[model samples]
Target: MSARRPYTVRFRTPDNNTLENCFYATDAFQARLLAMEFNRYIKDHPNRIDKIFSAAQR
Candidate 1:
């Protein structure tokens, strides 16, 4: 397996509150996939993810 690094997921809640979360992943694409799966399990909002990026980028 590859080493993981910090990544950020930016999303908006149903209430319009923008939030960001940090996760560790091998790459940006994996980070995005992780966020999508996480969003699916959220009870209040299943489509909250707006974008994913390497922490270094934004």
Candidate 2:
């Protein structure tokens, strides 16, 4: 029998220009942890708004 693989989830934006993110988790709890970390990143770096807008203009 083959070994079980860990669970993973990806969050993406509607526009294709921005960088995509992937979250890997061994289980549901880990998945939640990953999501929380991602959220914190967004909150801390609000300047990403400008980057996305500039990319769209190009």
Candidate 3:
């Protein structure tokens, strides 16, 4: 099994501001999913994810 690592998810807000968050997951796909799930619960309604990559790559 692979260990989870931190990934940085860059997303655009409704106001056109680009923001970033760090999520720990087994892979980039999982990190993106987690970001989307998090966006769902925010009062902003929807935030489009711009990119997702390993935090170490930054």
Candidate 4:
């Protein structure tokens, strides 16, 4: 296996706050998935605006 590098996933939260999350993955696909999941969680809750912030998943 290859070493996992720290990947950054940046997106605007539902509160209009730009957030950057660091993930360790071998490729961008995995990093994207992580970001998508996080974005999904941020959307699923209440009292927040839900929007697609991912490039592919959006």
Candidate 5:
């Protein structure tokens, strides 16, 4: 596996609230990918999450 670094993931919830969590990734691309995966997970569950974004995206 590639070496990973700490990244912060910020996402909005279905309730219109925001949440953040730390994730590991080899690079920004991978980090966003991981965030998208997590976003999918949240979407699959009710009131879980609404959006997935990288703190560094902006």
Candidate 6:
């Protein structure tokens, strides 16, 4: 068995806004994988990205 670690997924808007969404992981590789997946998800969904930033108050 291995020890667990903490990780954070940061979602940033084009205008420099950021959101910290964290999770627990078992290793650095897992954390990096999660970040990549989240990034890919956002990239694949343009409308969602627009909506997320547009809905935010500037």
Q: What TM-score number comes out for model 4? A: 0.55
**Regions of model 3 farther than 4 Å from truth:** 41-47
Query: lDDT at 12 for candidate 1?
Result: 86
Model 2, 1-58: lDDT tens digits are: 4332343433334453454334444444454455557766444543342221111123
TM per model? 0.67, 0.31, 0.78, 0.55, 0.52, 0.45
Writing each residue's lDDT as its tens digit, candidate 3 over 1-58 gives 8999999988777688888888899998888777767766332443467788897888
RMSD of 5: 4.8
Quick one: how many clashes does candidate 3 have?
0
**Model 2 regions lying over 4 Å from their true place:** 1-22, 41-58
Give a tens-digit lDDT track for model 4, residues 23-49.
Answer: 677776676666667667534642343
| Model 4: CA > 4 A from native | 38-58
Off by over 4 Å in 6: 38-58
Candidate 1, residue 11: lDDT = 81
Per-residue lDDT of model 1, residues 1-54, tens digit only: 999999998888768888877779999778777776675533255367777788
Question: By TM-score, how accurate is candidate 3?
Answer: 0.78
| lDDT of each residue in 9-43, candidate 5, tens digit only | 66566666778666788775566666667667544
Worst lDDT window (10 residues) for model 6?
49-58
**TM-score for model 2?**
0.31
Instruction: Report clashes for each candidate as comma-separated counts.
Output: 0, 0, 0, 0, 0, 0
Off by over 4 Å in 1: 36-46
lDDT minimum window of 10 residues, candidate 1:
38-47
Candidate 6 C-alpha lDDT tens digits along 1-58: 7765566555656665765545456664565555556576544643333221111122
Which candidate wins on TM-score? 3
In angstroms, the error of model 3 at 40 is 1.7
